[model samples]
Target chain A: MKVLATQTKSERTQAAILAAAEALFAKNGYERTTLRDIAALARIDPAMIIRYFDSKDALFARVATFDLMLPDLRTVERSAIGTTLVRHFLRVWEGERGNSGLAILLRSAASNEHAAKKLRELFKSQVMPALKYAGADAYAAERAGLVASQLLGLALCRYVLKLPPAVTMSREFIVAEVGKTIQRYVAGDE
Target chain B: MKVLATQTKSERTQAAILAAAEALFAKNGYERTTLRDIAALARIDPAMIIRYFDSKDALFARVATFDLMLPDLRTVERSAIGTTLVRHFLRVWEGERGNSGLAILLRSAASNEHAAKKLRELFKSQVMPALKYAGADAYAAERAGLVASQLLGLALCRYVLKLPPAVTMSREFIVAEVGKTIQRYVAGDE
Candidate 1:
């Protein structure tokens, strides 16, 4: 019973560390944010973070996991696939989940080599599979890349850089317009 | 003649500083690349950089100009506009000019606010005008934003992250495929 109690507390601490680390990493890009800052935000002792994570880099590796909870392509109507995907992504980014994992990955990928690797891994695992499922064949890999460029670019301009036009664009407008571009990228000629 | 000689020497110094700054900024990113490092690379006194540009921020502003010498939209065949733009961008990033200004901007924008601002300004001045010139009136701004996402995303993946699929794609393949997406973005219906 005592060991069980320790395990529950340890799990709680790990969850707290991950949540705090995500918020700090999202608000301040990787280089600027430190493990101490994450500990402070999580209201835990800094030693606890080091003990649990082993090191800042290791903690970041855990933090960089970008499971996007992407909707399976088989479930959506063929004609509405692009729009549905766009809407789903926007929902994930804007949802109560708050700062999305993809956002943090996007923010840090440019500056941190490890984060960049994770970002690429996320794209390969999460994004490419969906495109393949949606009927992309030999060129699915390339088509998925094109889609990434568009979607990632939008995230950079709209969320990260806060460019005026991108910032002001409504969700409906973005879904309709960017959705079309994504549709072409996924379904268009080779 | 005496004043002209002095001006020429000053211009040369400024050029050298800008060149060194761009290379360092691209390689190390913004936060890690400092004025002392830039001075060492340019083989100039650190004080000279301050005297000429006032601050590292000022030098960075001068260095962030992303002039692609974009072809006049009026001259290109209407049907081939997208391919032409994609080809031109690819050439600039991969050309004799060495590290493209856009590449540097992209590398730093994620971490530096000033760099992000410069990126937004570059897009506004360089990209939007081309879309307007191509006859996109009502939705030119939005179209430009969409186009920015795809091209910038390509730069991030191919140049910044070196994603395998993104890096290996041939120039012809990228231009043809990405061009179709851009064509639709700039000319497609709402």
Candidate 2:
């Protein structure tokens, strides 16, 4: 019973560290955020972070570990794919769960090499496989690249840069406008 | 004659400082880079940077100053406007003059609020005026926002993140693929 109790406490501590790390990374980015800063925010000894996560790079990898939770596009309606995908992304970014992992990765990717690599990996591992639904055989890679550029660009403008127009845009408008662009990139003829 | 010589030397020093600041800002980003670092790279005393630029914020504003040099889009053939604009951006980014100012802004924008504000200002000042050619009227701001998303995303993927597919795409291919999107954004029926 005591051992189980100790394990539960350890797990809680680990969770706290990850939460603090994610918040700091999203706010300050990878290069500027330090283990000491994370530890301070987590209310734990700095060494505790080292014990749990091994290294800053490792901690960041863990924080940035996210599943796009991409629905199998093969199952989505052909014409509705674009709107469905856009709505899904909206939920991923603004849903109750929040998109801290992606937000952290994007915030750091501009200046941090590690974050950039992870983003590319996410594209390969998550985005590429999903595009198989588009049935774009020879142009699959390019199609996926186009989709990424539009989605990521929307995220950058609305969330990071917070450009007035992008920020003020209604969800319905974004869904209609960006949705059409994604539809073309994914399914339009060359 | 002495006064004229002094002014010439001062102008030379100012140019050097701007160049060094641009490089370091592009590399280390705004928050991490220091005036001392810029001075070291420029081979000038730190105090000289202060004398020339006043402050780091002011120095960065100067470094980030860029004119998109947009063409009068209304004059271009309606069918060819997208290709013309994409070609122009390709030149701006990869041309001999280089795109250091824009690169510096993108690199620093994620983590620095000031840099992000500067980017929004650039979008307002340069991009919006150019989109007047699209004659979007009621949808002008939305149209400009969409254009910014696509172009900035291309820059982020090809230049900053260096995503493989985006980077490997040929100029001709990019012009074709992205040009269609921009044309749709600018002129397609909502």
Query: Per-residue lDDT for A55 in model 2?
Result: 60
Per-candidate DockQ vs. reference: 0.57, 0.57
lDDT string for model 2 (B26-59, tens) is 7887778999999999999998997776567657
Deviation from native of the Cα of residue A6 in model 1, angstroms: 27
Q: What is the TM-score, restricted to chain A, for candidate 2?
A: 0.71
Candidate with best TM-score: 2
Question: Candidate 1: where are CA atoms >4 Å away?
Answer: A1-34, A37-64, B1-64
Worst 10 residues of 2 chain B by lDDT: B98-107
**Residue B76, model 1: Cα distance from true site in angstroms:** 2.1
True contacts kept of each: 0.75, 0.57
Per-residue lDDT tens digits of candidate 1, residues A24-139? Answer: 87688667888889999999999998677655654675675556788888888777778988998788777766645566567667756767888888888888887887765688
TM-scores across all candidates?
Answer: 0.73, 0.74
TM-score of 2: 0.74
lDDT of each: 0.78, 0.82
